[model samples]
Target: MPFAASLASAAQQAQAAAGAAGVRIETVEDPERLFAVSRLLAEVWATPPGHDPLASDVLRSLAHAGGAVHVAFGPGGMTGATAAVFGPPRGHDLYSLIAGAKQGGRGVGYALKLAQRSWALERGVATISWTFDPLVRRNAWFNLVKLGAHAAEYTPDFYGPLDDGFNTGDRTDRLTAVWHLNRLGTPAADIADRPDPDAAPGPDGLPFTARDGRSLWCRVPEDIVAVRGADPARAVAWRTAVQDVLAPALADGYAATSMTRDGWYRLTRP
Candidate 1:
């Protein structure tokens, strides 16, 4: 199937899922709807009142400038939102700046992502790129395995120190996920044969520093959120370990290809 068709099919599947959960996705341009989305973002991130990441005006401007501002509504109210910014040299690419969903909205996040993909495709956008903390196992699985996005770059402290509740104590390192809007499908499933996370900092932790090799494995804590809250030192250790493994390799021309089932990032050289 062509890229657009494939994306459309994926979006259809996601829409069905959303509908089954009593959720619907819509494009928001009006100030009231956009303000609701901004509030949802702050709530999802647990951002303090004075530190709203996406102000209402910002979302309004983005919607007016041809960027996507997809809002997902569920039983209670606004359940999720996906905001993208149009830019880059190609003009056919978009950077997904922020996306989040409310608690208990099981498939709302994926649905919003599919909606964004469809929205971008209709407007001739070829790719959508976003960043996420590599240590978040669920997010890694969602972006890499479930959504079929590939990690193209790694930046240490990408956003400096994010003060949001989710990122309070940790360095803001991130893996840049390039969702080739045209590409959809699991790249590898059976290859991820590694075991689940263990306390040892070997395969269960961060992989050893990348050497001259075609492929490398990077591991993250099984539950970084819990670890960050209970053991700040361990969380910092996880941060340094991942930085040591990925920052160097990514700088040396390696791209994170996929994440394994056992919380490992598979990095490979082109």
Candidate 2:
């Protein structure tokens, strides 16, 4: 099937599910609704991190100005969601990556992100940032290689003691990734248009521009299955290898933003 048609079919399913539940996954136009979304995040990805879905504050912050959030619901509750708040101080929104079991797989996350992309593009925003646990190879492919987002290495313990949702006291290392939300297609294709470290900045004024950013970055774990062993030698090897790629990019100006709690990878160069 053609890409456009396939996308449309998936969207139809999402919308149909929404209608069945009398729920919509768009921005919170009302303040109370915004609070409701934060509450949902706690419920969906945090509490059962396991507990009640109404126990999160991370969802609340995304409601402020220059912010945006999306929520999905089923017969009893929300299925899954993706939220981001655009800005500088918080690396332009690299918050949570919580998906409910009812969501199934990438289809839901992809749809939510596409919605976020559409919202940002309409506003002249060029990028969307987020973090993910890097240990999971699936996210590495989805966020960096597949989505055309780049990654950056961040210091360990990036978010000191994160025990909620998917994170549970291991290594807090992460990689920050960016979806050139505005140029999702062109940049991911045509290598000539893509950022080449040697080239000058674009008219849009981005990294390698006056702001000083790296062109692109990412990491694929050398050994996927046994990466998190407690062996000190293996630990050093993993840390060193990941840091080498991310550190240079950071020193060159890429900063870590979103992180994957399940995999321990952080998206950077934001």
Candidate 3:
């Protein structure tokens, strides 16, 4: 099936899947109109108040690639959206995971995933990566615990300053996760074989260092970023930063044999 047809078919299926959710899914073609969408998305993402939506370079990039952007419309009005870039199976490539205040729990996001799956399956794209606020356990459960993605690394201040409902006191700490779209059938079984995430870090943690004073992994991702970005006087301090980019390494054959309860995860390759 051609890519466009695949998207349309997936979208139709998604519309059916949304059954009575009063949600409609469709591809967004007007890049310029995204200014309005960006404002909504920024609000949904909880970017600080008064955020500059015009600085949305990422959205521009997606449009440039001719990526498929889907928005979910509920009876009330706009609910949410998801976007993906279709490409052949390859590393060093990524997709975005942006959801809005859609009424249904994960409905729009699920629709977007199905659409991406269709595109990926047709193009032989094996993996897809996206970033989400780590502190948001809901996203974690949905993306990693449920969808089988993992935290590869911690990106400090993924986006700088501005306004969002959730970023008031902390800079957004994000985790990058992948969806092995080419995998046949449900990925639940495959997830069973993967190791678990590390336990939460503690005060008695080991000293972690990055290139210029960032933690080796992440400590209260949102908090640390807030500290780091908040005051130049108070340098960011944490037990972990500069994580080993676990998911990619693991997907590339590395394995997590064990994770300490004290928040340390050990990985090995077979």
User: Each model's TM-score, in the order given?
Assistant: 0.89, 0.56, 0.59
Model with the higher TM-score, candidate 1 or 3: 1
How much lDDT does candidate 1 score? 0.80
Model 3 misplaced stretches (Cα beyond 4 Å)? 1-16, 31-33, 48-61, 86-94, 103-106, 160-162, 184-270
Q: Candidate 3: RMSD over Cα atoms?
A: 7.8
lDDT of 2 by residue, 158-208 (tens): 666555544443566676666765333212222332333324422222222
| Residue range with the least summed lDDT across 10 consecutive positions in model 3 | 209-218
Predictions ranked by lDDT, top down? 1, 3, 2
State each model's C-alpha RMSD to the native. Answer: 3.1, 10.6, 7.8
Ranking of models by TM-score: 1, 3, 2
Model 1, runs deviating above 4 Å: 2-11, 187-213
Native-vs-model 2 lDDT?
0.50
Q: Rate the local accuracy (lDDT) of all candidates.
A: 0.80, 0.50, 0.51
Higher-ranked by lDDT: 1 or 2: 1
Q: What TM-score does prediction 1 earn?
A: 0.89
Error of 2 at 9 (Å): 16
Indicate whether candidate 1 or candidate 3 has the larger lDDT. Answer: 1
Kindly list the per-residue Cα lDDT of model 1 for residues 93-135, writing each as its tens digit.
8899999998888888888888888878877888888999988
